[model samples]
Structure formats: structure tokens, C-alpha cells
Target: MHLKLIYSKKELYFLKSVFLSKVEHGGASQLCYAKHCKDVLDFSASLNPYPPDISWIPDMKLLLEYPDDSYYNLKKAIANTFGCPPEAVCVGNGSIEVIRTYFYATIEKNDFVRIDPHTFGEYSLSVQLAGGRCTVLDDVDSRVRIICNPNNPTGSILSSSELIEIARSLEESGKLLFIDEAFIDLADERQSMINKGISNVFVSRSLTKSFAVPGLRIGFGVGNPELIEKMEVIRPPWSVNAFAEDFAIKALENLDLLEKSCELIKKEKIWLYEQFERIGINYVPSAANYILLNIGADASLFSKKMLDKNIFVRDCTSFGLPRSIRVAVRTREENLILVEALEKCFQ
Candidate 1:
């Protein structure tokens, strides 16, 4: 005989509804294309088309051994890069893991988490998963505020002074602020709040986009030592794998390669913008590696048309921008192919 298990109504609802909801994201080439489509070019995800040279492989001995539970070496490397104390760094599997950790560390049940409407979806999803409420930035009563610098999809950015003032205001009001600077390396690093030593603010940085190592999944958070310590408590041990830790350490030592990649991205961004102008495609000016195009109707059909040619772009309907599509700056050759494909779609 089978024994019946029991769950509370609230628990059952969460399991059936919240947990079952599908999560959408960009850079899903495997999902968007067939297994054998080796020629598929992805412009949906924002990543440095030219990644830093990581030719050397990790030591075989390290692969056999478990990663450091505290991720001490990785944190030290990130601290040095950002010019902050190691105590102020908290490494994670990715920026998304750090984001969820922040929510778990700070939010109590039913607490309010404020975010800009068009920012990353993870901010809202994380808050909801933690049993917290999500509010818009215009709302005055949130317990926490989260912003994505050089925001996703739109690629809009807030100035350093503007971010500082927002942090100060939130601090004065006894609220927490989280600034996601995942794309800041591709933008202006000088405008980053990572080295600001702001007590009430936490800056989340990703190695995935800028380093072009999304598969390795490395990210970190910088904040006051006390807050970092609190996040560390809730973060799982060995959350960052051995390979990722080694990769990040090596990547940090070679800053020149990252700089070169960003330079290429900036140049290609200009070319892409000019192509959009020539094609009479409406787009938002971007500070990061991606631009948002206003396609004048649902972007699904346009995206499908491009995908048919082995080119993929992000459909921004889920971001509440129904008529917009966000495309990342690719290599000159690749961008030209996309332009020609888009011309056909437009015609």
C-alpha cells in the first residue's frame, strides 16, 4: 500500500504554481535551434564577442579536490580587481546566485523589494521566491531597492553621482540597495559603485558577460564587510566550483585582454547603430554592449524570421517591451550577416 504525504495549502500552492512557472532567458541557442545547427549565431545574450584568452587549463589535481568552501582565493582576486578588502567580497556560482543570496539574507516574509520595471527579471523572481513582495521604484514604501546598472534589454544606465545619491537616500531611510553592474565592464568602469565603500549598498558583478565565460559561471558581490559576512552565512559551501575559481583567478590577472575585448565591442556597437539607422530601424541608444530595437510590432515574428537564417535575438515581450528586441554587439562579419538577414525580414 502507498502512504499518502501531506502538505499545507500554502506549500501546495507554492509547489504547484510558483515553482512550476517557466523562467525565460536569452542566449538559449540550444533551445532556439536544432542540435546540429553549428552555424547558429546568437545575438540574444550580451557577451563580449571576443573573450579573454584562457588557453591554459586548470591543474588536474585541483579537479580531483573540492573547491574551497569559502572561495577565499576567488574572493581575494575579485577584491584586488575592485580595490576593496577581501572581507567585502562574496563570490557565487553566478551573479544570479549572489542576487538570490542577497534576498535570502535580507528579506523576511512579505517584505517589499523595489525594482525598476524593465530591469532584470531575476530581481522580481528572487524576491517572490523568498516570499517577499515586489514594488516599483516609484513606490515609496519598499524595504529594499535593486537596480541594474547599464540595465538589461534596454541597456540604459544611471550616472555614478546619481547612484550615490540613491544609495544615500535609501540608507537614510533604513533600506537596503543592490546595484547589479554585470555589464559595467563593457560600459564605463569609473562609474561603478564597487569601490565606493558604501555601507548600505551592495554591487553585484558578473564575469560571465564581460569575460565571455558564461559556461564557467563566476560572479561576486562587493559591499560593507558586515553585510558581506551576512550573505556568506546563507550562501552554500563550495557554491563556486573548482574550475570556475581557477578560471576567475587567471582571468583577473589578465585585465588587458578584457579591455581589448571591450574596445572591439564599443567599435562594433557604433557600426551596428549605423546599420540600424540605415535600415530605418528605431532603437534606443545604449551604453553597454547591447541595444534595444523598437520593431513597431510584436518582436516574435521578427525573431522567428531571423532564427530561420540561424541568427537569434532576444524577444523583449517578457520584459514588457512587446515591440522591442535586444541584440548584442557581435563581430563585424557576424553583424553584417545579421544586417542582411534583417533587411530581408523588413522587406
Candidate 2:
């Protein structure tokens, strides 16, 4: 009788089935595992809708050859933009590459802390690959959290005061804090931690997002010079291509372009938010370019339904939120298409 008093096992089987079925197609170019899909009003990626100023492309062609050791000129341009020394900036193919380097450099086996239910699946994969124990900070211990200013998937933004408090706790605890601000460019730069010179905080940035240059694959991580130096030691020789470095140097020169683009996006983001509010869909307020909405209990089904009509969106089921969907704002027309598609789905 005592042995037969346990709970039923059907729930265990269902959990196991869901876990086993979670597989991602990493190498595919298209969104949400779909190929050759048309009528794409993709709100999956947070990249800028506008292209970069290309007035200097012809002159930049000279840099199509090999790169120098220092990445001096490129570094100088970035330094000027961030108001840091050239050495403080460690560039990479993408900030993701820099993230891998940091995990290997700063963390050892049995030493990693993560804030639960966040983006960057690769971070967990990298941490495990490096033989580190991944511990998550739950709601109970909100002090030492590694927040994503405007968090991905859910798209909720923490206030600057909240972030500062967490940073202070991590500093007191002597733990590392990695803040991925890849989508922050879509918001007010004044609200960013980088602008505040927050210590003990390593901020990873991706030009691929706000510049619409995912093809170029350029990004950087800013932190203390000592940590950045260690990361640079682990970085492969010539990790960034000549073309990417060249393009980034020139892109930095035209800072006005990025500024103007962000303004345009801010306007579009407000309009898109209004539409979402009007539709009565539940969405977290975002300071980033994307919005995450709870599209009822059948989000995966709704996402597939939208894909059939050729509009791609990020289904957050993989991120442990089955009813949530994350969508990036593009042009006014593109956002309208998504609104129409979602209206049809709900109807």
C-alpha cells in the first residue's frame, strides 16, 4: 500500500516527450526552420530595417586584402565612438564569438551563474562545453541577477536603477556579470549601462542587429581592460575578416546614419505598440526593437499558421514559453502585414 501511494507517471512521460522533441535546425538561413518561404514580413530578427550609408564603399574596397595585427584603425574608430582606449575594445566576427571567448577565459569548471529563462541558448551550450556548472538566480535572489536590459523572447526591460542594483550585488559577491545589449541600439542610448561606465559588467554588442549587417558578422564586448586582455589572448588570430573590419571602420565614421535609423525605428516601434494594444494581445513593454506577445495558448499553432501564409516570426515555445511569440518591427507596411496576419489568426 505504501509503494502504491506515489503520483501518476503520465505527466513524467509528457515532459520527457516534449524535452526529447526539442531540436533546432542551426545551419538553416531562413527563419523558424522554414526554407524558400515567400511573402516574408519577418519580425524574428532585431536588425535595422534601413541599410547603412554606402558612400565610401568604393574607397573601402582597398581593404579587401589582408588585415593588420592591431586592427588599429578600426579600433580607433570604435574607441572614439565609445570614448574608450583602442585596447578596451575587443572585436570579433560577432559578439557571440566574443561570448565564447569570455566563457572560456573568465569561467572554469564548476563556476557559472545564470539568470533563468533568458535568451542566448549558446551561452548555456558554451558553459557546458567549457565544463562549468550553470547555476541560475531565481526570483528569491533578485540581487545578483544578470539582466538583459530589454530581455529577449519576453522583451521586458529592467530600469537602469534595477540594473545598477544587480551590478552592485554582483560586484559585492565577486561574480561576473555578462549583459548582452545587442538589441539596445533600438532604444535610447542614454539608458544603456555602457554610457554609465558600470564596472564589473561585461557588455556584449552586435553590429549585426542595429546595422542590418548580419551578413558582415561584426560585434564587440566592452568590459575592464584586464578581462578584455584575457579574452583577446584566447581569441583566434585574425578572427575578424578584412572586409568586416574595413566596413566597420567606415560605418563608425557615419555615426549619424545609425542615430537617424534609431529615431525612425523608435517612431515605428510606438506605432506597432499601439496596434498591439488595439488588438488586445498581451505584450510586455519593450525598450528594444522587438516585441514579445502572448498569442493565446496555441502560439506554436498560430506561428505555423502564419508561416503557411509566408510571414515568419519567432515562436517562443523553445524559450520555455509556449504561448509567447517574439516579433521584430520592420517597415510600417511590414508591421501592418503582421497585424493583419495576426488578426486573421485570432478570427
Leading candidate by lDDT: 1
**For each candidate, what is the lDDT?**
0.86, 0.72
Provide TM-scores for the models: 0.94, 0.84
Name the runs in model 1 displaced over 4 angstroms: 1-20, 32-36
Using TM-score as the measure, which candidate wins? 1
**Residue-level lDDT for 177 in candidate 1:** 87
Q: Candidate 2 at residue 142, lDDT? A: 27
lDDT of each residue in 58-100, candidate 2, tens digit only: 4565566667756778877888998887777788889778877
After the best TM-score superposition of candidate 2, give how far the Cα of residue 305 lies from its true spot, in angstroms: 0.3
Q: Extract clashing residue pairs from model 2.
A: 43-328
Candidate 2: global Cα-lDDT?
Answer: 0.72
